[model samples]
Target: MSMTLRKRAVLAAGGLALVAALAWAFSPRPLAVQTAAVTRGLYEQAIEEDGRTRLRERWVLSAPVAGRLQRITLREGDAVAEGDTVAWLQPGAAPLLDARTERQNRAQREAAAAAVQRALATEAQARTAREQAELAERRSAQLAAQGFVSATQRDADRLNTHAARQGLEAASAAVRMAREDLVRAEAALAPPAAALPLSRAGGQAPLRLRAPHGGQVLAVPLTSETSVAAGTALLEIGDLRQLEVVAELLTADAVQARAGAPVQIDRWGGETPLRGRVRRVEPAGYTKVSALGVEEQRVKVLIDIDPDQPAAAALGDGWRVGLRILTLRQTDALQLPVAALFPRPDAPDPQGRAMAVYTVDAEGHARLRPVTLGGRNGQQAWLRDGLAAGATVIVYPPAGLTEGARVQARTP
Candidate 1:
């Protein structure tokens, strides 16, 4: 009877051990997860965009009048001073006149020459009349002093002298006008090979196109001598010291980025990032096709580079740059790594602020916690509520991990 009881107990012990082994093999294991602790710190929201350097003011020098432009001696990047002579222009040759036009011009010239002669003759007569009036005035004054003429007569003589002098001056002015008319008529008849005199070319020796202001030449449209019409662009000039950054931002982001906000300039092929400030947010928006072929409305935001920063000294116009416009910031806020949060299964808020994270409970179980998100940057998220400081949350929960499931810290 004792042997039978011992055998039965041994058999039952072996069966219990086998059943325990099977149960252990089939049981759910604690999930390994990466975790992070929520902390209170400075949080910022910034919009990053590509930008390019551009001059705040660009000046285009153009031909002032229709003429034959001389060869431009200055090359691009040449420094120029205000009022520096950049090029010389000669008045364009007169167009070939038809037979009737040539005859008319010849007749006009002859008429002008005759008018000049008549004006000169009239001037000489007026001069003679003035001399006679002056002599009569002197004689009349002497007569009046000698009691031989009336005072009223002497006054009339003085008035006559003044009128004669005025007539002489008018005749002289007429002669000058007649000469100018004759010069114009001659210019109309001048041939292409004929060189114009100084009087015909506005009384200046040569027409000099001068720089409007001090700047570096950015472009030269006409390097060699050629005939150009009035208002043809000759050179483009701008000061490098006035460089600014222009960033094309989405309309939605532009509205939020106000003027006067601080900006950080990066990726400008420099050793350090540069500083800048928003100068303007252009009111107009333009449509642009994105790289993915999506039409997007974009606005230009002008940034004034801080001239005091030496890092931007070498930057030139049209250089590519990266811009980070700081829109919002909070000094003391609860923040977490963006990786720690995941999309919530619940209906999202209007701003899509609904998000959740799996916080590790004291019992080593993942507890789903819903969080109201505030601001977010590239790598961090600001939480408005639902999570306390120092709370441990899963950074990236494994697939199939459910609420209240046991979790273990992932081995480094």
Candidate 2:
């Protein structure tokens, strides 16, 4: 009876050991994961883009009339005061005439001379008629005063005299016009030297172009002395103190930008970032080709540098800088690392898309929880719901992580 009982107990113990080993081998092990604590802090959503500084006001000096422009001595960055002479222009040389053209001019001069003579003859005839009418009018007035002639005859003579005076005035004006025409004809036949002398002393006075305002010379399109037409640009002037930054942002990002938004200017060869504010968001968007050869819609955002800041004085026009426009800001918010977020699978919420994270409980177990997110910056995301401060969330969760999975926190 003792041998049988000992054998049964030994077999049962061996069977129990086998079952325990099998369960130990098949059970799931804890997953190793990185974690970050959710905390309350200031949250800001910003759009980062490259920008360039430019002058607020630029004036382009142009040639007022066609002339020979003098050589400009002023170089770029040179300061000039208001009313300073920036350029000098001499009267352009007259066009040279060929043999045939000279002959034609001579013929025109002869024709003009003949026409002038005809006008003078007509004027002289009108003058003589006017003198005779004046004498008649005087005799009529004298006769009417003496009551020897009728009133009708005196009135008719007076009307004739008035008409004659008008004719004489017209004739005088014609004579003057004739003389002017003759002078113009003679000028056409004269040599170019008579009109515009080659020597500076005898030539017309040179024209002077002065600066309209005090500023630095930005550019000079004309390199050397040359003849320029009217409205040709000569130089550019602008004050460097009034500088504004322009950032080209994607259309999607620009839509979120608003006037008075805070901005940070960086990477402008300065030790500290400069502060600025959004002045404008351009109304229109333009098509641009990206470095990846993709077509994108882009818009411009203008930022005004804080004039009182020390950095403003250090910046100049056309300086390249980096701009971070704060589109959204919250003084107090619950935030978590952006890397911890993952898109929910299967059926999403009513919003059509949902996000979640693997949250670590007090017992060190990973649990999936859907989170309602607000604004998101580059490093952190604001949590509107489904999370609280002091909670731990797994970052870059493993592919096999599931709800209620055991996890071990990784060393920082």
Candidate 3:
């Protein structure tokens, strides 16, 4: 009776051990995942873009008149002072007239002569009328004194005399204008050689073109002597000291940038980041085609580098740089890795704030935590709610990971 009871007990024990071993082997083990801890730290929202350095002001020197410009010896970046003779210009001679043009000029001169004669005749008529008016006014004065005429009539005569004197003065002005016109017409008949001496010394003299500003020559479009038309751009000058940075940012990003915002200038072949401030966000936006063949709206932002900084002296116009404009920043912010967050499209919150992250619970299980997202950058995000500092979150949660899923922190 004792042996049978003991065997039955041993068999039952063995069966129970087998069942436990199978369950341990078949049961899902904890899923290994990378995790990050939510921590309180400094957070910044910034916009980064490529930019170029440029002079704040550029002056393009152009020919003031159509002339032969002298060869410009000054090279780019050459220092120029105010009132320095930068170039010389010889006035271009009048074009040679063809036979038909010569005849036309002669006819025009004759016409001008005739106009002068006509103006003189008109002046003579006006003078005669003025003399008559003055004589009549003298008589009217005498008559008024003798009481032969009413006072009103004498006053009217006096006014007429004054008007006649004005008319005579106008006629004299017309005569002077006619004489000037005749002289100009006669001068036109002179040969080009006669007009070569434009100076008071009766010698051919070239006009000196002086620089209006003190700066370096930025560019010289033409180095050799050549004839240029008026208003043709010849050279460019700009002060390197007056320099600014220009960056084209996405329109959305540009709107967030405020004037006088801090900027970090880097990747400009410099060892340290240069300090700069946003001078302006241009009001206009332009369409730009990106490398991916996408159309994007971009706005230009001008940044002013602190001239007092020694690094700024090394920069020149049109130098490429990397710019990061700090648009927003917060201190002691509760933040976590951005990779920890994911969109919950299947069950979006009513407020449309459906961002969630997998956080490790006290039981070492991944628990889906709905978080109120705030400012975020490429690497990290500031959470407004649903997570506390020191809470561990699963970074880059796998697709198969779900709520209440068992998880274990992966060793580095």
Candidate 4:
């Protein structure tokens, strides 16, 4: 009986030992996660966009008259002085006339010549009438002085003389106009004069296109000798020293941009980024097709490079660069990595969304804490409430993490 009792006690001990071993094998372990510390520092919220440099003022030179343009010897990058001639344009040759057109011009000239002769004859007749009326008036004046002519007769003669003088003046004017017509008719009948070089074209000089201001020649669109009409673009000129940056931003983001805001310029193949300021946010928006095949409204934002910066002197017009426009900034603010924050479930705020983060305690346990966010840059988020400087928070928390869950911090 004593041996059977001892065996039962041993069996009971073995069963208890097996149960403890199974419990130990299936026990839960702490979840490992990355963590970061909250800190206080200067924070800036900025929007990044691509930008291009452009000349502030550019001038495009064009032909001033229809003429044969001389071959342009000036090349791009050539320095020009104000009022200096840049291009020469000789007078264009008259178009050749066909036999039919020549015959028509001859007929018109003959008609004009006949009209002038008729006017001359009319002028001669008017002169004779005026002479006859003047002689009659003189005779009537002498008779009236001697009482040989009645008062009514003398008045009639005097009116006739006055009318004759007016007729003579009108005829003289007609003769002058006829002479001008004859000159025009003779010119039309005459053959076109031979083409002359600009220097000796009847004392009239060739059209000289001069530079309106001092600048470097950017382009000469027409280089070969050819005929060009008036207002044809010939060259472009601009001062590279005065450069401004233009950035196209989405309409939604442009609304937050304001003039005089700070800008950081980068990616211009320079070691240090340049500084600039927002000069203007254009009121108009334009349609642009994005890389994703989506149409978007974009606005132009002009940025003026800081003249004091060394990169300003190195940069030239039409250079591509990157721009970071600071929309908001806060100094001495509580901020943390944006990765640490996540959307909170069933905790929607007035703004339609709420954020929460996992805060690690001294015992390496993660506790869910709701946070009010103020603003965010791409990498950092400003904390408005529910978080303080020096607090540790889990970054990119793992799935299935819960309140008061055991956690192990991963070292960077």
Please report the candidate that would top TM-score against the real structure. Answer: 1
Give stretches of model 3 more than 4 Å off.
Answer: 1-20, 94-202, 345-354
What's the distance in Å from true for residue 398, model 3? 1.3
Regions of candidate 4 where Cα sits further than 4 Å from its true position: 1-20, 93-204, 350-353
lDDT of 4 by residue, 1-412 (tens): 9999999999999999999998888878889899999999999988899999998667777764467899999999898976678998875654567899779877867887888888889889999999999999999999999999987577666656755665665566566556555554564455445333335537435666777556799999999999998569998887666678999999999988887777899999889999877878999999999999999999999987766566577787798999999999899999999998888786867662269999999998899999988888789999889988999999999899999999998766
lDDT of 1 by residue, 158-254 (tens): 6568657756766765676577667667866776445354645454345676776678999999999999986799988877877889999999999
The candidate, 1 or 4, that scores higher on lDDT is 1
- What are the models' TM-scores? 0.71, 0.68, 0.70, 0.69
RMSD of 4: 26.4
lDDT of each: 0.84, 0.82, 0.82, 0.82
Best by lDDT: 1
Candidate 4 residue 235 Cα shift, in angstroms, is 1.0
Q: Model 2: which residue pairs collide?
A: none
Q: lDDT by residue for model 2 over 300-341, one digit each (tens)?
A: 999877665776777778989999998888888999999998
